[model samples]
Target chain A: MSALDALQATLADEHAALYTYGVLGARTSQSATPALYDALTAAYRRHRSRRDQLRLLVQEAGGQPVAAAAAYELDGRLLRSAQVQAEALELEVAAVERLLALVAQSSGTVREWALTEATWSATWQVELGGAAGTWPGAPELA
Target chain B: MPGRPLSRRTTLGSALAAPLALAACDIDPPPRESESSPATPPPPEDSALVAAVVAALVRAQSVLDAAAAAVPSLADRLGPVRTAHAEHLEVLVGAVPEADLPTAGAVSVPAQILPALGAVRRSEQRLQREVREGCLAAASGDLARVLGSIAASTSQHSAALATEVTS
Candidate 1:
């Protein structure tokens, strides 16, 4: 696989990840719900950078950058005020799960790109909501 | 029902971007175990890398084992998954014949959230660090696949634990 292709893959996964956190940020209070806000914002920046990195790689490889999608399927809540935080978590976890599977499929340069994306996505799982931040010594939910 | 198709409005920005970001979602491909072992070589290629994987798997296995043992009724699902991990461990151990992946030995899994999370976090962090470092040390495409698989599994485990806390 090529670097451009891997970057394209990350662009998509991060897109979903970003969308999910957006929902989570709205539903619960920071103090009560957890500082998932910080995690989400960090993810947004990381993903955007990855998207850009992919573009650079594509440009270097003489290939056109992969474009983003029209509208993503968030956990059925786009405008906030929805009971979709858990659903959003599920979606993000599933997205990262898919990326892990994709990395297994690809090889060479593309695989390298896949690994990078998967590693970061997993970190979000721990940091944002699921396990990492949930436990003590974990980033505070307070 | 079938999912939505890649509509025209779903520009390269929307459709393609999602796939790229989640591209690492994958299973750990098995390591290539040769019919014969190699001789010679100094320092070794991936001692740390292999150790990291071994540690993660063992810790994971223990967590699953304890969890399954605690909730023995869930053996229906846990049984198969445990078998799968054992097999995976064998394959991983065989990959680096020279080194023995460290066993958890006597690490106790606390019944409470704090200690439990701490144990899991340590294992997860170790694997994550290895995955990051292994990407740099990998000599073959297969190794990368295995590393990715292990990392994903650890990620899933971490997420699973978090779900318990939330519930």
Candidate 2:
């Protein structure tokens, strides 16, 4: 994939991530589950910032950024705090995959940015109560 | 579900094709390139980059091993991080020739458990930075992807170690 295409693809994933986190944030009660609420809120904001950055990157690369879908299908019901955290973990894992692709398709400053973002995404997985895998983004190694 | 698109599969397939091929092979010595061979070989610096990362992993593994030995109580916590570095070393060792591989030097652990754990955490953070730099400097996208993944995994290790030290 071209660098621009990779950026757009990552942007699309960020959009879905933001939407999912928004849903999760709504379900989490700050008084009852303060930690989970904060994590979800932090994730939502991070994804939003990433989405905007991708838009600028796409434009600078001489391509029109892909638009976010109106809605995306959630993987599972977010009824419980555990369920909400699990869903957020899933999103971050998926984000790591997308950012790894971006690293693979781009070079120089773009690749550096993707690497930093992928590291943060992987760290977020642990913050969300997931195991730290030997290979965070490269599942083929696993 | 917001399923990943097919393009990601294609991208990863193309990007990882080289390293995955290397990973699948036995640890046989790589065949020397002949004048008649038409295949484009990776730049010399790529090999150097991989070798440097392999050395870093070896050092990190040694540090973890020493820390675990000094503090039996924290072995369970240090086990996964050690395993991760070992696995990373195995994969990267395939990328460089046997002759170019670096040996693991002696590493010492502090007598106190907390200080030993703190030392291990610093080692992981240093390894993480080295791998991240290697990822950024890699010439081949395949190498960059692999290094980037390792960097991410190392960062998680560092974070876990920090949490363990404080908690």
Candidate 3:
């Protein structure tokens, strides 16, 4: 994939993440599940910032930024806190995969940025009550 | 996922360079052009970066082992971290030819559980930084991808360790 294509792919994934997190946040109650609520809120904001950054990166690379879909498919029941956390973890893992591709396709500052983002997403996997896998972004290695 | 175009070439070159680089570590010999075929040039820089990362991983594993031994109660918690390091080392070693790579230096762990966990966490954080730097410095995109994933995994280890230290 070209660097621009990788950026667009990541941007698209961020859009799905933002949409899913927004729904997850709504399902979470601050009073009943303060920790999950806070985690979702933080993830939502981070994805937003990353979306914006990716848009700029795509433009800088002389490509049009990919548009976010109107809606994304969600699986399983998200009514429970555990379910919500699981969904968020799944999204974060997907984000890491895209960011890893960006790291491989790009170079210099862009690659550095992708690597940093991938690291954060990997940590988020653990924070969301997921296993800290041997390989976070590279599934082949795992 | 689609594979990178250069991945095959890079992997082959890295596999070939691994044993030579590990062997050079003991002798500290100069780079030898004749050692590699002209079609597959020796990746001296990548080899060096890989060696450095491998060394760091060895040190991190030793520290975790020492910490686990010092605090038997924390052995269960440290087990997964040690496993992760072992798996990482295995994958890295798989990239190179079979040779005696550098071993870990002596690591002293604190007797106190919390302090010992802190030491392990610090080692992980340092390894994460080094691996991240190596990812950026890597010549091959394939190697960079591997290093990037390793760096991410190391960061997760560091974060997990931090949580353990505090809680």
Order of candidate numbers by TM-score, starting with the best: 2, 3, 1
TM-score to native of every candidate shown: 0.50, 0.87, 0.87
**What lDDT does model 3 reach?**
0.78
Candidate 1 vs candidate 3: the lDDT winner is: 3
Task: Give the lDDT of residue B96 in candidate 1.
Answer: 54
For candidate 3, the TM-score is: 0.87
Root-mean-square deviation (CA) per prediction: 11.6, 6.6, 6.5
lDDT of 3 by residue, B112-167 (tens): 98899779878888888888998897755567778888888878877776776677
True contacts kept of each: 0.13, 0.51, 0.52
DockQ of candidate 3 relative to the true structure? 0.30
Better of 1 and 3 by TM-score: 3
Which candidate leads in lDDT?
3
What residue runs in model 2 are displaced by over 4 Å at the alpha carbon?
Answer: B1-38
Find the 10 residues in a row with the least total lDDT in model 2 chain B.
B20-29
Off by over 4 Å in 1: A1-3, A12-39, A73-82, A101-116, A126-142, B1-52, B55-124, B139-143, B155-167
lDDT-sorted candidate list, best first: 3, 2, 1
**True contacts reproduced, candidate 2:** 0.51
